[model samples]
Target: MLDAHAWVCCDARMIQATATIRCAACILFLNGCAAPATSHDESRTASSASSPDNLSAATAIAHTRPLFDVMTFSQWQVVGGDARFELHALANPQESAAELTLVGRGPIPRNGFLVSPRELGDFTLTVDVRIGSAENPRAEAMNSGIQIRSRRMNVGQGNAAQWTIGGLQIEIDPSSRAWSGGVYEECGRAWLASLAENEAASAAFVLGGWNRYEIECIGPRIRTKVNGVAAAQWFDATVAGVLAFQVHGGASCEVAFKTPMLIEHGIHEWRALADEVSGSSGERCAWQSTIASTTRGVRLEIEGAARVDLLADDGARLASLSTSPEPKISAENKAKPSIVELLWMEGEGAALLDGVRVAQFACVTVPSRVRVLGESCAVLRAESLQRK
Candidate 1:
């Protein structure tokens, strides 16, 4: 009976030991399946969370450099009118950063501008602006704007001549007209785009508080938003110029601009691929191309017949198209300069002649080279290549 009892006790101990080993193995397997993320995985997860659109993705990954240092005014120069600018800590509870304040001294001369010396072509810009403060809500109905693709010009004659900034101005009207976010051609054609037709945009501006303005310029298209509402969009011939802040003349008002950020979509000049080789490369020698990773498009100014070829990295031609004048063009008009553009993604591509679509095709690869075969082509331009 004692031997039988001892054997039962030994059997129970063996079963307990086997159960312990199986439990340990299960825990090890579970740990291997649910491992912790590495730093690279964490970064990718963060990037994916923040990028909601192409612009956001570009802002997140490619262009992380600021346009200017907000703490100093060294990168900017004051042009026209009598106004003073000072960087001060914002008193608003919603914001903690310093704001650049522009105070029009008194009723003086022409329009005053705080201009940037650096010129930009295609870019996205955002700024927080306030025309008046709570201390002084009615500040002479201050009129102001963010100027882009602008230039300095000499107006009047002799001693009357004064250097004034003139170009595309995004209107900031706090008056009854409520033309805030409208596109105005300063010192040139006036009111290229107005909010008279857009009621939602006209009501976007806050009278005594801060308003956020977002502006984008790509190729010939210009778009604007006021306080998150679509304000204006216009296509123009203006390509590149300086940026400025305008304090409209005839109004002694105070304005504030804070957190001005810009992401530049750099312009790339085309290079002749055939010139890279030794002797003449036959018909391919006429080809001028830009090896860039462009998400936007390519622009070409062609005067005669031309062929554009999109090539892969292995010199495999992805797609090719012949350019011609638009259907509306007469025989005589064909001799004139025509604008041709190619916009493409991984799966689709389209060719535009004089802003009208001429051809569409399936594209399998993102072009490694964009070559153009033509004689007397005026311009070949593309967005700068962005690499992570």
Candidate 2:
């Protein structure tokens, strides 16, 4: 049995393409990158923090004091069509991101996925996905998505494509303008609720790049956020099932998934942008993108009105229209400026403003602090925070 009180807000980060954590009613529900907690784990974390040599423990806790790390063919199975999986090269030359690419060389419109072994209920899930770049504007419909509370069963469709998964699907539509964060019921009624009108979130997903996806499942209410912007939320009764990352067959397109995290019974928006425009200055603003992950997804997008480029700590252009922001999708997903993070990624919040260098904001989870550039890097007053 699992204790209800032992919820550990953890970093459910994908250490490698294969390294994933699972929780049996144990976890932190932030950023969807959380794991289960156990008795005495807190004391172990405190002691391990002082000893850096315990990389294994530190690594586990670093992501989110998870009880079990699930990897390998034993913990995962490939479903839906004959697709291949391998740890391949990353698009960004500078990042050593652990990503599993699903190369679909089989039939078109093939829906393949790596399904987890365990079935979970009432949890938050998040993942970063990068679809194959389209050669032109009229690109083939290379689609991908994350499955929630789903189950695998052999459909009547014989051969390698016989296995079918059914449940709720968090759609990742690179081709459609407003279909990224929308939720659809698989093998059942379709299109539960759409984010078609949410222009900000619909525009949040950039084509041919990494995009962050957050899914919160609590009771009958399921909310989804894309790139820290609240996309959609609705109610349903089908509670518990396995999780899967899908590589929907498309126009000879390959898909990659990284930073897949799960927390039992919670939510985190650790990477959400806090303050974009300064209160008094109002001269600058910020933009959050998977490309901002280099600096943990916090980049300064100077206000167009300012018309002045911002420099980094080394005096290089940091925030400019022509800078062509680097491809950064924080191993931990980040929220946008307008996000009302229920409990940001592991209960921490991040913000990027018009600052120079690869530095902008620093956040501490315990006694959560938000820091911004002012004279020197100082702690922003926590007047609104309450101590229990």
Candidate 3:
């Protein structure tokens, strides 16, 4: 069974810019949900040096540590603002997956407030999220999440599962699917369709409060464990980069990160594809990001009727690159058309049709050092776009 405690302090609404108190147990809770208390003699590891600076109003409640207690300060940074804690309901309806509790209040507006930066690939990100307020007698249970490899968008998509950008999301809600601690590619991938099955321990561990969430990324394989139970495992070479957290709007929740760490490993070797394209369908060809001199370009060369769209890490539209006319001969022996390219820049975004019309063509410029991904719908075919 899990060991925990609860208490209500102030009944007044939490201030938006106020910072939260630090608790040692909350730190151990992040290390590993079931972790025992540490002794005074036990030496503490240093924190990441690269952890994000510049806290925002929301994240003011997030925890921080000195360099001496942890490892590289350069390791982890607050992706967005400081995580804030608030109360929404005391106990919400318990569903098939997990119960909802702890709603976040204040400065955490109803919508459109991004908490952090983009997160992708290999991370052991942990947060302490709860459902009640210190002062309430009994509040409705709330639901929250620790978003991994997440990208935020506009207000309209607040409740949508797809509005979330790419990367794995450890869902924190109670549903029959038990999506909690499972790896989900937001807006891009399907729901719990690619997860591992028959893991009783993993499923059982995720049923309670303040559970620890851990994500391990090596090459295309991703493993997620909740409280030491392997809840989900996903194998896809297409993902890489930072991490994030999700504070469901209108719900009361507080997120805290203690001794956050980011460690980089040497590149892993893998098979290289011969052609980036498959057939006429643009199903098999892969996407590539190349740097020519100072200009950065993202290319997709696929076979068949290839329909491609490029999007910024923040869910903003950039450009769509696709091939057409599709390389064929007409009855009159006329020439076919060329491929399509879309370009977009900061503030200004455009789609270029090239010789093709504006409707069929577009282009978006990929900024230097920014991460970009290529997406193809199920209608496109099963072509492999491998990234190195």
**lDDT (CA) for every model shown?**
0.59, 0.46, 0.35
Q: What TM-score does candidate 1 get on C-alpha atoms?
A: 0.54
Residue 159 local lDDT, model 1:
61
Query: How are the candidates ranked when ordered by lDDT, highest leading?
Result: 1, 2, 3
Report the alpha-carbon TM-score of model 3 versus the true structure: 0.41
Lowest summed lDDT over 10 consecutive residues: which window, candidate 1?
23-32
lDDT of 3 at 327: 57
- lDDT per residue as tens, model 1, 197-314: 9999999998878899999876656789999999997655455677888767775667777667767775422222222221125664454554655533555555556676667777
Better of 1 and 3 by lDDT: 1
Poorest 10 consecutive residues of model 3 by lDDT?
26-35
- Model 2 over residues 123-208: C-alpha lDDT tens digits? 76666767664542333366767788777654654353255677889888887665888988777767776777788888888677
| TM-score per candidate, chains pooled | 0.54, 0.47, 0.41
Q: Best TM-score goes to which candidate?
A: 1
Candidates 1 and 2, the one with greater TM-score: 1
For each candidate in turn, give its C-alpha RMSD to the true structure in angstroms.
23.2, 19.4, 16.7
What's the residue-level lDDT of 9 in candidate 3?
22
